[model samples]
Target: MFKRVLIANRGEIAVRIIRACRNLGISPVAVYSEVDAKALHVRLADEAVLLGPPAPGESYLDIERLIDAAKQTGCEAVHPGYGFLAERAAFARAVIEAGLTWVGPPPEVIDLLGDKVRSRIAMEKAGVPVTPGFSTEEPDMETFEREAVKIGFPLLIKAAAGGGGKGMRVVNELKGVREAVEGAMREAQGAFGDSRVFIEKWVQKPRHVEFQIFADTHGNIVHLFERECSIQRRHQKVVEETPSVAVTPELRKQMGDAAVATARASGYVNAGTVEFLLDKDGQFYFLEVNTRIQVEHPVTEEVVGVDLVAEQFRIAAGEKLSWTQEELSQRGHAIEARIYAEDPAGGFLPAAGPLLYLEEPRGPGIRVDSGVVQGVDVPIHYDPIMAKVIAYGPDRETATARMIKALEHYVALGVPTTASFLRDVLASKPFRDGETQTDFIELHFKEWKGETDQDRQIALVAAAILPNGVKTLAQNGGEQQSWRQPTPWETLGSWRIGGNS
Candidate 1:
């Protein structure tokens, strides 16, 4: 067990890691940029160090600075929570060279699996089915063109070292291959510093499913079942659920076994996810491997009743896995909705402003993981995700209903959010029938505006009441002094007793 651990990230994930460390009796050390000096994660950690300016290149993404901070803070281990330096193999190696435990997979494994082309090859060698694709160190346009024709139309041009939908493009016809390939190469170079790109046949109506797998240094590995992440926009998942309604008991076993095999082949350790694209015919193909804890891990934790973070710590400490495959089983369905500070009406552009008023829902089977607090400024310098709302229930219907209710009650003022859009998607007929696919958002929501009469009414009421010195609903509980002086109603404007005006 580590006496102290440095969390080299920010936002809700940092806060989440801080709580996990505390619960395990480990003091958490947090690092934050100048803009995040007053962030929730910094406030909650036992100790915090200033990184640099607001820019990620100078702050959170600085590997050398992160290592120095951990060593100087007397941290025995470093936990890179998801983004920033989480999947950077070089960072993990740096942490190890500094004599601090890295709470993730081995650096060599990260390097191998980080590259999409190499990972696909590894999965194939491990007997896991992968989509037909072309990969070459020296990318020749002619070679790519030939491969595209063999793979047929509607091929995907993807970065060899990409995630989050960046550096990716879809070519529907032969005429678009050259333009798509060149564009993908440029984007991939800018985003990942790797100019390598590959082409794969795009399976139509594919459901994005992922299996969470854990491995210990002792060579023990097990898969924690699957998460249905097909509810996406721009190739990024917005909503994720566990025990996918699409994956049956038999299909679960097959995918779980394949996931475990893939992890073993890559010499993986700690936590990682094996993502697959499941077609309508129930055939699944390996998509990619995420070498760090996923953002949607909570849904798996809710159903499996396992504290994944704790397990990560245990694995990094060289302890054997606590639970065996036989001991673990899914209990119920869980759904997670990412609440980002973005406007769905404005083409889902990121919105940044002070969270004038913020309220998160709470109740049985509902969990809210957040980093922002009321009055906190959401800067434009980072990801716009403000929080995650997760709900668990005995079945999918109940979980879906709970998520809708939770999204409805969630409130944030001074900045628009995707809460309403998430609610609409959950209530839509396709989602209700479990007809989720990779193109769910594009197929159903193209040109779909989110404007609603309820939103207008709420805005009108808020505008009409706020100027009258009436505090917003979220601000009513605390002791507040009215900024405005006595109004006409409070002074001499009120009717006498029951007399009419």
Candidate 2:
């Protein structure tokens, strides 16, 4: 095992990696930008390094600076949690060349699976079921036109090099294929520096399901189970849960087998997620493989009782997988709701401001993984996610009820959040009945407006009465003094719909 590891990321994931390192008696080194000088991850780490300014190009995304930080801090490994350079093969290769263990799959494996077209070809040869698509390196409009006609209308032009809905477009008619392809290519180049795009058949109203798979250098691989990620907005998942109501025991076995096959075909090692789209007719097709730990990984861990981050370290240290496929079993239902600083009513547009007051829910079967603290500024420079609220229970109903209560009790003033929206989602009849398809939001909440009359009134009262003597909390201190004074907002007392004093 490595004596020390450098976490090459920020926000809640950085805090998560720090805790994992402490569990294994390894020192965690955190690198931060200028804006994050007082971030929670930096405070929790055993050591910290300043990369550069707030801009990612010179800070978090700068491969050279990251490698230098690892070397200077004498870190034996680097863990790229989730986003920003996590899937970049060049970054992984650079870490390995610097004689530091990269806590992920080999760079070659990342390179192969990072490209959608190449991964589809690999899965096809491995006998894995993939969605019908047309892809070629030849830049010919005639070829694309012929392929689009054969695939029919309502096909997708997707970026071959990246995911997360970037560089993706839907063409409903043959006449729009060329323009869509050009737009997709331009977006792909801007996002991933790769101009390659491909055509794929669009499956209507399919459920987005994914399997969490792990492998080691010792030729052992296993799938932990599946997560239902059908509740989404703009192609990004907002709610995720395990023990998908749609997957039966028989279907689970089939998808599990296919997920394992996907890892084997790519010579995968360490933690990775194999995504699939299940049609209404019960047939499943491969979506794509995420080469690093997913944002929704905690839901899988809560049910399966596995520390995926710890497993990543073990595998990177050349240790074989400790558990077999037969030994693993899903015990209960777990659901996660991502709390982003955005407005659900305004099309989920990102919002940034000071966190005047912050409170997290506490109880059995409830876990909050958060990055920001009260009295801190929410930067607009990066992902707006502030925390993730996860709930676990013996059954789906109990879990859903717990999640709704948690979101209701959670509060963050001075910025908008999706907490109330998520609470409504969990309480809705369609979600309760397990009708979570990819278009769940489009069908149920096309014009949804959050913030009830009472809630809005409370927010207004709280903001109006905030005194000028508001003092920011002390950095690296245990005790904090409340800056609020006597006001009518305080008369409303704690345990309101969205917050407490």
Provide TM-scores for the models.
0.93, 0.92
- Residue 116 in candidate 1, Cα distance off native in Å: 1.1
Q: Over 4 Å off in model 2, which ranges?
A: 454-501
The residue-by-residue lDDT of candidate 2 on 1-501, one tens digit each, is 999999999999999999899998988988888777667787778777889888889999999999999988789999999888999999999999999999999999999999999999999999999999999987578899899999988999999997888899989999999999999899999889999999999999899999999999999999999999999987899999999999999999999999999999999999999999999988999999999999999999999998999999999999999799999999999999999999999999999877767899989899998998876667788888999999999999999999999998899987899998999999999999999999899899878888568678877776676543343433322233234442442222111222322
Model 1 regions lying over 4 Å from their true place = 454-458, 467-501
Encode model 1's per-residue lDDT on 1-501: one tens digit a residue: 888999999999999999889889998988888777667887787777788899999999999889988987788999998888888899999999999999999999999999998888888988999998888889998998888999998999999988988889999988899999899899988767888999999998999999999999998999999999999887889999998989989999999999999998999899999999999888999999999999999999999999999889989998999999999999989999999999887788889876767889998899998988775678789888899999999999999999999999998877899998999999999998998998888888876688757679888997897756855433543323222343433233112223332
Say what the RMSD of model 1 is.
9.3
Instruction: For candidate 1, give the lDDT.
Output: 0.88
Q: How many steric clashes does model 1 contain?
A: 0
> Candidate 2, overall lDDT?
0.90
